[model samples]
Target chain A: MAETTAATKTVKFIISRQDTPESKPYTEEFEIPYRPNMNVISGLMEIQRNPLKADGTKTSPVCWDSNCLEEVCGACSMVINGKPRQACSALVDKLEQPIRLEPMRTFPVVRDLVINRERMFGALKKVKAWIPIDGTYDLGPGPRMAETKRQWAYELSKCMTCGVCLESCPNVNDRNSFIGPAAISQVRLFNAHPTGEMNKEERLEALMTDGGIEGCGNSQNCVRSCPKGIPLTTSIAAMNKDTTKHLFKKWLGM
Target chain B: MKGNSYFARKLHSLLGIIPLGGFIVVHGLANYQAFERGPEGFAKGVGLINGLPLLPLLEVVMIYLPLLFHGIYGLYVAYQSNSNTGRFKYGRNWAFTAQRITGVITFVFVFWHVYQTRLQVYMGKITHEELGSTMHHIASSPVFFALYVIGVLAAVFHFSNGLWAFLISWGITIGPKAQRVSSYICMGVFVIVSALFILSLVAFRGDEFNEVASAAIALLGNIG
Candidate 1:
């Protein structure tokens, strides 16, 4: 029987790197020791430890953003193998070798795999994607929601603001001011809430503004690209109806 | 730049489905009459449309104005968006890009078509009876034939895919199942309409219409 050596088992990565946000991006290759069930994040961590290029030259460690190693936290979202997905959950064994790691270009690159997600956050704020609750002192028992409504609401609530949906969207480029599907879905999520209903009209009105719901090109990419499988396009369609109704109401002085 | 108002976007989608889309379907079916009844049937259909009372008003309101708004606003919307099919190569993303690209090609082609056919008629350079022969004159050339072929395909795609997008945008087809069904239906519409339009083009291919075209040109020369 032939003996299998661990030294021969290695994973290759072609990482796009930028030393600074203002600097140009370039690719660097690295070969890391392969481990069973390893992920892109694990490979990145290995690169961080060794800081060696594939050609045996010493180099700076690759930069990326991550918090929870699991997929819940959206910080580690990047283009892995040309798909915008969570780096934490991308298994090396499942991925074809020479794994490509690049920052999601929809946003401005902070450096390497880390991108500035301020545009997404700005969109979230524009839509007021939260239930406004004032007074810190013991506000007991907010309004209850029906079980079915809560079930779907929980699904919408799973959006980690990871910017994957935006990254995959065509309308969310530098020239366009479209708020994107993620923020629009958040509007639907908050609008469905019992307490969030208080600001429902406000949210709808905000969506009627520039870069709001009108920005959606109905590309339907957000729903497909969402790692959490959030029904983003459904929310957009619903909001399209709501915003139209709101516009009619505003015209009628209702 | 600030985007269109919510009402404007709604109107854009609405106008596309209504007067414009309705006009394409009607015009396509009218042209399909040529396949069964030859060029004379197509001429009669054109004459019928021309014979309507206050025809210019109807043309401006139902066709020209709505087309202008939809086309110009569509151009604006297309300009404001970017295509990311290179990164996210989903079916819907590709359809999105196709919709925009076809919109542009259709816009240019529609303008040329109107100028060649309708404007000439309005200017009294050609009569309604000469419509089939004029179309034959245009289509007999390899270059114009290629242009019409591409233009017709683009128009068919734009209208069909725009129908699907309209259903989703208006919240008519919210779920994946409904969207899938509507997509297949729209594809059927595209194939049928495109076949009919191409058939009409082919109907005008022979030299039989050239005699009528020669007479029309002779009349124009005398008037000039």
Candidate 2:
């Protein structure tokens, strides 16, 4: 059945390809065997198996980053159908013809469909989006968070470091380091955690930096684009309030 | 830069909106006059503005100084920001590009407006059929009109978008409900202001007040 399917019909894809970090990008067309219930990832896998372009030219297999086949990882995000989204969950049948695939330009394309998401991680670092636990010594089960707070913080912790939000954010481009919405949201998440609050001042201090929280242009695009439905702009507003209070506190040396 | 104070940064963003946002409100109101009175009425409206005591001085103090300060500070802030393109922690926030692009366009538009209206009028370079007629002529010209339309639309979107962020930055808004309400108000104000300006231009072109203003200007010239 698989062989018959391979011989019967083809699904076309025009993928943007880059050979190296510095090299100019070009498109390569591929026709893969169509099958029922084929997702974008499965189609890409078929191409990997063939490693042949539509012109019948043998080429290296296309390179892309993916961890979970589910949309949870956000590693396989790219522009599909003129919209930035995750490839893992993008169904092939729902996509229009030409099936245009391009790397998200918000990040430096490390290779075809692979981008350097280091900036996002760096922003996370800058904001200290984690609990600063020093040792492996069994610290008695960490201080408990309020149930209500934990519920919301859990929503924020759903962020998979996916660059989808960043890819869709206009402020995350090469021109400005506005820290974007994802980091701000993460700040809210970590700062709300019981132990994470230990570094609350540091996180607040990070947000008060030049490329920090003040950089948000508040386009609200992040809220719309987030696959996780993370309340980014809300976090930004919360942090805005917290930072203002923090500023006053600093002024009073509280 | 840690602990160096982000107050300047915050102030920079806040002060930057005044020139562009405030100008839109004033310009929109000025445009509304064109709808009813025609080009001549529009001109009269502008003339009335000039008649006010210290009008030029006020423009210099309020408009020019704010424009310069905002533009310069915005540029400095833009330069200081970190350019890290990646999947942001949240999602599609294009605040920086929108602000910068709109700022440039607004800057250019304001300069041209002053050049044609204030400089030319003051220097006796070219007289309008009436102030309204000149406005109509400018708006009727495809190039000037196109630029004006684009500039104004951009200005409106930029202002509304910035207003959302500004409210958030200052802690005026707290939750989803607040944001929704504020967003509607911002968008509503932007639409009303922009419509008023467009209507004024359209009315001026329809010759609503041009004939009267032209006749008046001609009669005054003959009498003098």
Candidate 3:
């Protein structure tokens, strides 16, 4: 009798749905049979399988983008229960009743739960958030960094470009071209590397441009909302000081 | 994109904290003289500023130019950013929005304030010594009084909050603990400065200056 009762238990979800890139968004509710330790992605999958609303009407399968089922991928990030986080890690049992899911609207929504993260990528490109190393020849062991520096750099390197930080950021919305915190942290990571230090001035100059370090209003939501716990504000503050020095260097024609 | 250069962005933030912020602090203290030493003291403070060497040049270089650059560039920056405090109600997020809002209010208030007072003096309509009476007259109007109150409060908030932001952006307070401590200090500055402005307003309120002037005259008569 206990087993039967447990089997009959259900979990409900209200998902914000958009049919096309330009279409208006709407919400659809679904009720799925509860399973122990079920996550939001699994619940979404159940909806995809049935494609039915709570009132028993047939509907299109809910569309979302995901690759790695793990939280590391950051592909399944959405507004789960009004908090921007990964759906893969948001367990049904853990969230409040009638779980609500919506796309991170900081980026333009493509459809349903998928959003175009091109802005974030564009910022990464603008900031040159990478180490330019030639792969043509066999370069030997790279320059070494102190363990203390390397440890913190590793923490910053954990960023997955998930766009959660940007979503949580109030300054990174449609009107502002602020590059957001993730890319700023990425700049810090690469600039700290011994190989990447060669282009330190270049990276600093890139950050000194429009939509760069100056655009940050220092709201500090990015640090709290980052899934990997990257020290975003610290990186921003560091970059802020570096960019000012770069400005002075340019002024002195150094 | 027009004012979006590296130098432009950096200068905007720098001007906000430097000469512009310095001017605000000086101006607030000068106004506070009204409460501390009454009308004569406030006039003396204004007279000292006006009596400075190369007064026009000082105003143009330190006050006007920086104010123009900071104000225009600030408007451009504010236009570029959007506020999302409704969805993200974090304390910092709210501060972010409040900074912009207060900046805009301060801009408008500064324009009207300069027009009403300094412009009148510049136009040779009123002497600098009469500024106290002028202020009393302006405060006598309920609408202008309310506007000045809002404007002064907004300016105070903008300066205080901008100070905290300036510290972080300049990397003076990088760690979370340091940033939190700086926030408290900035808030204290805001409260103290705001109280000073309010006291100044109260000292200027509706014909109270007349009573103070009469009291001063009586004291002078006794001295004579």
Candidate 4:
């Protein structure tokens, strides 16, 4: 194959950058030398290589978060062109020009692209959204889930703590303390486990509290916005059933 | 079929009992009005509503008859839905179950509220002094207020939640994805409505209506 001399095009990015957590955000434009197959992160890297603004002023290299640049870690998730998504896979060729990148507004912006994901972590803790595995060494061959249940649960397990579901969610604003769909889906995931079932009643009871599963309005946005395509609303609906059953069981002294 | 056909009819059918549902709305509205009107205006509002021509007779029919019908029908529907939902494995199914369960709780609360307020009003057992009493009245007594608070909360869950599910049941919310978005929105609404009721109760309990209202005003004023 004859190697063709390829021309590089300039790709523009308008990023909302902040120096510190308390600093006011401002827009910075960059015209990165684009390669044919470059992704958003690669373009960002090009900017990082030469931290000069389009207006010809030297500035600090823009900061962002990224890991498992294959879009699995969800560390690089942001709002690209007004949509919450992973930046690692957001290709320069695919997006509209002057690609707008901002931190997902659902969480507090830690510096620039980094957000305080503590609310999601806190919600996971509140719901006990984990298998109660002890660190006394591996509990060797723990109780297994039914194949059918495992299939659904495997879907739930795909959540990467990416805040996309929460970002698209309307209920997760500062005024309210909704735990968001990811946590709710996690509740379903943990409660379905055999070991997780031991705390099933506890998990259900936790969800019964204010800002628990009852906080879900069934907007169904999380399922839609999920990049890994986790079935979030299904988990919510399943957890709802579990909580109700738990409530009845408690009421009946069963 | 998708836009406001089936569930709207169901809601309309439910709304037809508004004579009783009206009392629920009026009573809740009246109680909430205490936040704005204070004890005197609330009392006047109570008296004015009560003083409407043939209101006593209307109260007997509108209040009790619809109460009896709606209460029994709600129970019946709850029972039927419960049976129909036997051993369903879905979360939405559970949400529906919760809605019915909340409906039962609200029904019980409404029955008790009538016992304390509506029936008491009819029997002339409630003095004018007791009329405009705030959260304590809604909460009623300490023991009763606890139940009332939970019940009002249950009603909040039932109505707001049921309405959301009702949207789904009618197919207004299409697909699993959009349904999820709506569910999230509905959850947000649940938080908001729950907060409003919770704040209202807490304010009533603390006898801080003026303070709460002022805070709300300041908050709104700030927003503006």
Candidate 5:
């Protein structure tokens, strides 16, 4: 009954905008013709085609990042309606007006809706969230993982380095340097790999360092906010246990 | 101080549950004697503890030292935590913030409570028998009694909620469902323990203790 309401013919948007990396952010309102199945990205594209303010004034086109136009890439992440989520999957029909869009400030904001997720990348580097391989030496096929192990490993592998978990976490703010949950889960992912297990101790060691798993305040927000539904809290707990073991092992000189 | 911090954090969490949390539960049970029997029973419980061999050493090792570390390190951790609940309003988000807030409140309340009671005992200001009467004096005051109620509530809450967080960080509760159940269990623990301590506080306000305490107080010449 509400679908065909004349009031629903147009979608309203209040997008937070920053002209440059160092610029003060401001919110601008826009109105776009509503379509039956239009997602937030499609609404932004409509604004891009004809950039105009709701007051009928000419303005620059609102800029945002999106690829795969699906929820998978996570590059399209932004705070929509006060939550860190992918705009590509936030359908206009499902959102309340005026739809509020802001950049996730867990990392530095680049421009409009894009944030520089360099901290997440830096965390991934710190934890060594990768398997080592020498392509030039023509190594044989890597050790096979059991189907059972692979099933769970695939869940963690789905993490697209989205900053949603970090954005949702209060402990991951500027004052504390908590590595956040995404990278922690990635550590679990890489360590579970047969080849990646060779450096399990090293990964666990990295996790024990400053800004590691210990920095987690156990707010448990990361698990709920993850669009990929990666078991972020479980990884954090698993890693917490591993680091405790590694600490004792070092203490006993094992 | 700026090293891995893994051991330091783990040690803080462990110390909180160990000597500190254990001390709270035991203290609650001991105080319950006031409600169970009267001033005589409460005095006897304290006497039993004091009569233990190496009592001072046990107090130092099991209570003071661990509390010092947990309280001090917790303050440092609290200073570093910047909770933005206004932006991200979630249940656990508030709980994360509440844990830090209750920690500070509990520490302050505990410090004042100790300074008022234990430090006085050490300074020969209050004798062993007069301890119950001292509680009677404090709990008889509406202000002190209210503050005591708040202090006990904060202490019990911090301990019980800290238990929940400890289970997660230590990997005992691995999933959402497990964490949810643990929260309920911890709250259940909080309610039971808080009732015991509060009942003790209320019992202390009763005048039955002062007559027995006065006889003992008569022996301590020129005592406050």
Candidate 6:
């Protein structure tokens, strides 16, 4: 009788499903046997295994993405009960039921819970978010960074391009071309490097254009929603100052 | 498309604080004379401003142009924001949304205010000395009185919140702690400055202000 009671306990999920890239999205409820410590991804895996609605109707297996079930990969990001976050880190016990999952509408949904992050990657490319280093041959020992500078820079280096910041940001959406906070912070990271400083003006120039740094409305959602706890607002403020100085320098013919 | 809003956007921020925001501070303090010294004192403050050399040029260059750009560009900025604060519900997020909402309210209030006062004076409907009496008449109606209260509160909020954003955007307050502290300071500005405007509104509605102000206006007209 005790074993049956354990078996009967279940967790319910309401998943927003889009059958194809162009399909009309719908919500489907599923009940899975409750486990001691199941994350949203593990519950999703259970749904994939059974592919049955809570009403006992047969359905197609839910399609999603997950790699490195830890939070670092950022591949398992979705709207877990209205807040966009990494599903792998959103534990069943901690979340309010019935747990709801939806694809981040900031990006286009490719299939159920799977969004195309092309725009996010496109934004990174627009801002030159990485150092342009060729690793074909060995170079001399890199320019030394101050220990104090590296201490804070290390915090910013944790960004995994998870798209969480973009989803949470009010400035980044379909209507506008805001490069979003992630890419801007990455620009700050790369520019602080001794060699990366060479391209500093070019990067700042990129931010001075359309869909660039000017788009930020200071809603500051990116900092609060960042799973990596990166100081996104700090970077934005720094870049804002940098961009303003750059504009003045241009006017002065500097 | 690579758009360069860099300069225009920066100008909007700069103008908000410099001449436009500066004007709000002066305007609030000037109106406070109504509360502090009754009708006679309020007219004296208005006279001092009008007596300034190059007053028309100063008003046009420092106040009107900057106000036009900031108000119109602000409307565009507000419309561009597509995010809702309901889900996030963070303090900064709510402040962000409230800033945009108050901006629109303030614009309407400012236009209506200018039309009723400055425009009327320009049209010779009232003299500088009669300004106190005009305000009393306007403030006498319950409907207009309520509108003035909401409008004053909203405009004050917009100025205080915009000051906070101006500090961050210009890189003065970079850390979370610094930003948090400035938020408090700006709120202090909002409360104190709001009191000045509200007190002036109450003074405008009082019987003493109307009677004394009308007599003063008549005496001034005879001397002129």
| lDDT string, candidate 4, B1-224, tens digits | 23422222334334433554345446556655555556555666677786799986886777666656656655644543321133223466556667768878988887776677666756876454454442354653677667766887787676656656654433355446766687787787667666655545554654543454455457767988
**Candidate 3 global lDDT:** 0.86
Scored against the true structure, residue A34 in model 4 reaches a CA lDDT of: 70
Against the true structure, what is each candidate's TM-score? Answer: 0.94, 0.75, 0.93, 0.57, 0.95, 0.95
Candidate 3 C-alpha lDDT tens digits along B1-224: 67556678777777888988788788889989999988878888999999999988998899889888988888877887777777677899898989988999999999999998999989987667767877887777898889999999999999999999999878788888889999999999899888888788878874756665456557667988
- Quick one: best DockQ, which candidate? 6
Writing each residue's lDDT as its tens digit, candidate 6 over A1-254 gives 99898779999999999998888999999999898999999999999999999999999989988899889989999999999999999999999999999999889899999998887788878888777777888876778899998888888899988999999888787777788999899889988988888789989988888888888888899999999999999999999888878878888999
Candidate 2 chain B worst ten-residue window by lDDT: B83-92
For residues A147-215, could you state the per-residue lDDT of candidate 4 as single tens digits?
A: 998897888899999899888765567644567888877887887788888778777777766566644
Docking class of 6: medium
Compared with the true structure, what per-residue lDDT tens digits does model 1 show for residues A124-241? Answer: 9998998878787977888989999999989999999999888888888866778888889899999999989988999998888877887888788889889999999889988877
Write the residue-wise lDDT of candidate 2 on A42-87 in tens digits: 8889989999998999988999888888888888898886678889
True contacts kept of each: 0.68, 0.51, 0.71, 0.03, 0.65, 0.74
- Of the two candidates 3 and 6, the one with more favorable lDDT, higher being better, is 6
Model 1 chain A TM-score equals 0.96
3 against 4, candidate with superior DockQ: 3
lDDT by residue (B1-224, candidate 2, tens digit) is: 33443676676557646665776687677667667655545666666676779977887777777777766766665554433334333322344555666766766776787787767877885554356656656877888887878877766776776787678887789788998788789779778877887676567566545565577668888988
Q: iRMS of each prediction in angstroms?
A: 1.5, 5.1, 1.6, 15.2, 1.4, 1.1
Stretch of 10 with least lDDT, candidate 2 chain A: A168-177
Q: Provide the DockQ value for model 1.
A: 0.68
lDDT of 5 by residue, A1-254 (tens): 67667756889999999999999999999988877899999999999999999998999999899998878888899999988899999989899899999999878999999889888899999999999996778888889999999999999999998799999887777777789899989989999999999999999989887888988998777887899888898889888777777888899999
Error of 3 at B90 (Å): 1.1
lDDT of 3 by residue, A2-109 (tens): 998787999999999999989999999999989899999999999998998999999999999888888898888899888899988888889997999999988889
**Candidate 3 wrongly placed segments (more than 4 Å):** A1-7, B206-208, B211-224
Instruction: Provide the lDDT at A79 for model 4.
Output: 87
